[model samples]
Target: MGDYDEDTAFLGQTGPYFWTTFFLLNTVYLSTGFNGLYMVFIGSAPTHHCLIPDVNLTREWKNAIIPVTIVDGVEVQTQCSRYKLDVVRNLSAQGFIPGRDVNLTNLELEKCLDGWSYSKEIYQSNIVTEWDLVCDDQWKVPFASSTLFVGYLFGSLISGQLSDRFGRKKVVFISLAAQCVSVLLQSFSHSWKMFCVMFLFVGASQISMYISAFVLGTELLSKTMRVLFTTLGAFLFYCIGYMTLPWIAYGIREWRTLLAVLSSTSVVYIPLWWLIPESPRWLITQGRVEEAEAIVRDAARKNKVEAPPVIFKESELHSLTPSRKYSMLDVLKNKNIRCITLMCLLLWMAINIGYFGLSLNTSNLSGDPFMNCFLSATTEVPAYVVSTWLLKKYPRRALLSIFLSLGGGLLLLIQFIPDTLQYVALALEMTGKFGFTMCFSIVYIYTAEIYPTVLRNVGIGMCSSAARIGSITAPYVIYLGTYNKVLPYILMGSLTIASSVVNFFLPETLNRDLPETVEQMQECQGLCHGFRKTKYVEDEGRRNQPIQREAKV
Candidate 1:
């Protein structure tokens, strides 16, 4: 990409082509947000208890058949254990009053042999109820959510190489189609196993679509627009999609119907193939010089600007075509690149853990589940907006550290807020969500910039794969709430705060030109940035003069 940016500067940044591409890609991102968190409603468990038969028991005996347990200092009917049904029936048959004649609590308890009764106050039916994933089977609930991330793990690994080999626009549409098909198939699942199987594909396709679109935008747009598009333009649309989820689920309580509705909306995005072009920069890197030139000329025409007779310098075009292909390992082979990659991996992991952990925990928050979800999604809007502004004004490392600390500190602060002031606790949680949302939005743009174009998607994919570990673990983190309501927040907050320190060890990427090659990666400069560049780097730099010059530019 030596002199590539300067050569294509004629294609104005704020033009019809940029807007159309930005709008279309953001629409895809919107769908990602919608589908990504559907589990919040679909997997939520409503109030349930062991089913008691009415054939032989009195109303008092039926009530006494279910055992009660104290959880979180509150007396609640136990969901799993129940009094021995035969014993309860015998007591009632003897014309004995349960409390006076016998101690109901003294009766031995057993697992729910028949089934469970679920309340329909909020959800009419969900996966939890449909598959009896409660009590003894409760682990399946979180496992179901984690299955999507498991899909994401594998998807992120391959999608980058696929997009790099095929094309971004192709991968974007292909992934969208796969996402829609998988989601539709998931809606028809007859059992938990079937649902999870489809869910894996859903997760894979969704993240592939997300990462491809992100990298496409990064390459297709100008540096000035890239920041805006990657941050507010991209995530705001995602937030818009996220905000719609609770309302959609609010109307359609059944998981199958809800998924069908969400998947059906993909039809509108089909025509974007003609509207969005392959990344001109990506094409140049592949040595498809004429094709890349034609796209830029078409963009210039759409912008009402006169096209230069020659867009790319002959020397630059020759240099753009690499002697050999690059792989994800290229990022790890260099000390500076490897250090940045490792830091980003930890950063992305922590961000995903905090982000998804809070998002999935919205259902368990104190309020109407729909309102809590909507509020959580809505918080991301301001977070993205503020982040978009902060990114322009501050160094990336500082902003990331501040945002992560702010988010994590607020979550930790909730432990001090008494349970009596629930609104206050909820507000604190939302504020914590706000902080993590900002971190979430920034990390995408940050990681994209940290890596060079040669390995941008692969680098992002690797970090994204590492990030799935956090998302995969997030459900279990929230699952900790079953034991103590505050455990999830405490753990998430602690991790967020600790991960922020890693940013201080990484280099600042604000206002810097994106590295076009591994040899062009920025030097690490921070308090603890002690990594030393290898000796072969000097020989490589002297051998590739144009790339070295571009790095300095």
Candidate 2:
């Protein structure tokens, strides 16, 4: 087959049409960023204590009804236990003061049978406060967050095959519509179980839209712009969305309103369907040459450049006519492809574990929840900026490993910071966030480059599915902080460092032509050696060039 890049060369890079498509598709990341981490606020557990009826008791008796326990060397009101109502009533009826008349600690203590009173200092309403997911029901909070990633796992698996078979543009819009409906439905849920059910769909649709748009950009943009588009353009918009979420939550201080407001933003993106065209490269793969040619011709016209009379040459038409279908299983059957897929799975998983773990744990940090989340989201701006610059100059393999190690190392150091120096710990955590953000941006470009056009979506989907496994586990990992705050950091750090070491086994793809078919994939030469690019060699002596293979190892 003819080189796809060469055939589309007439369209050129950075034209009016290209810029329109680029910006429109990347705008979807804004919604993705908002939805992905909104759970941080939606499930935030505000300070709370057991409720005490004040009908017959004095103000001091009312205060004394809630039991106090020492936590972290300081006395605090217990959330799950309170003094017995009968005993407190009798004491109050006798007009006895709490501290002066008797020792309150010696009184009978009971479970918070009357329910809990949540502090309204930070949040007016959230799933945690609304459903009372505290003490005995606290497990539901992490489980609810996990349900979204569970949906993400399933969505990744489904969207990949659908995008490959139907088309990228189709899946993008369908997922966006699904995301809007699911999130809107989620805000109205009366029970935690119902919220979780809708959350699953929200997770599924959001990631599906994100992955489809990302893969679409990879196919549509030229090599010169791909790194910037993937790293800075898309993620910076997402960072803006993420950074804005905390402020919205700050103003609203209620989960449902924040969610409804975020979900409604999707309606504005429905019109993007007309602005963005289907990938011509994908059309060519599906043997729809005329349709692909028409799109390119229109692009050339909008680019204000004359198109070549013949877009797809005779040989290009003849070679690409026999279409072959591929599946995720095909990726596993090949040794070279399987190795790359395995490494990608682990790499994406490790990145997600670090990324989501830090993001979800932001509320637990020593600061206002809104400010902590905003800082976490804001860290990505410089991360993506630096990642974009590094990606252009360094080899993908080395840069990815360095970023991963930097994240893991910073996370490990957080455990050493004294509790009194909380700002120092937070600075270390933000630096870790920066490291993971950079790695997250680079890995997308690296993975897209590793797979061939036919298997690209499926390959990325498989890796993303693995990433969901990490995302699904992230909440539980953060939950480990309840037992011991340092445990999560230790686990995340060790896994990240191991994944950094594993990244070296994968081959580099800097300045390389994207592999069009499985046969053209670059082979990783073991530890001591580098990569060997596989391509068809045209005969210099013959009038008619035939496709013959040669490998330079």
Residue lDDT tens for model 2, 466-494: 88899999999999988788999999999
How well is each residue in 466-528 modelled by candidate 1, as lDDT tens digits? Answer: 889999999999998887888988998888888898888777788887777665666655532
Cα misplacement distance, residue 243 of candidate 1 (Å): 0.4
Each candidate's lDDT (Cα)? 0.85, 0.87
The most accurate candidate by TM-score is 1
Candidate 1: which stretches are off by over 4 Å? 284-293, 310-316, 323-340, 448-459, 511-553
| Alpha-carbon runs more than 4 Å astray in model 2 | 284-291, 313-315, 321-343, 448-459, 505-553
Instruction: Estimate the TM-score of every prediction.
Output: 0.90, 0.89
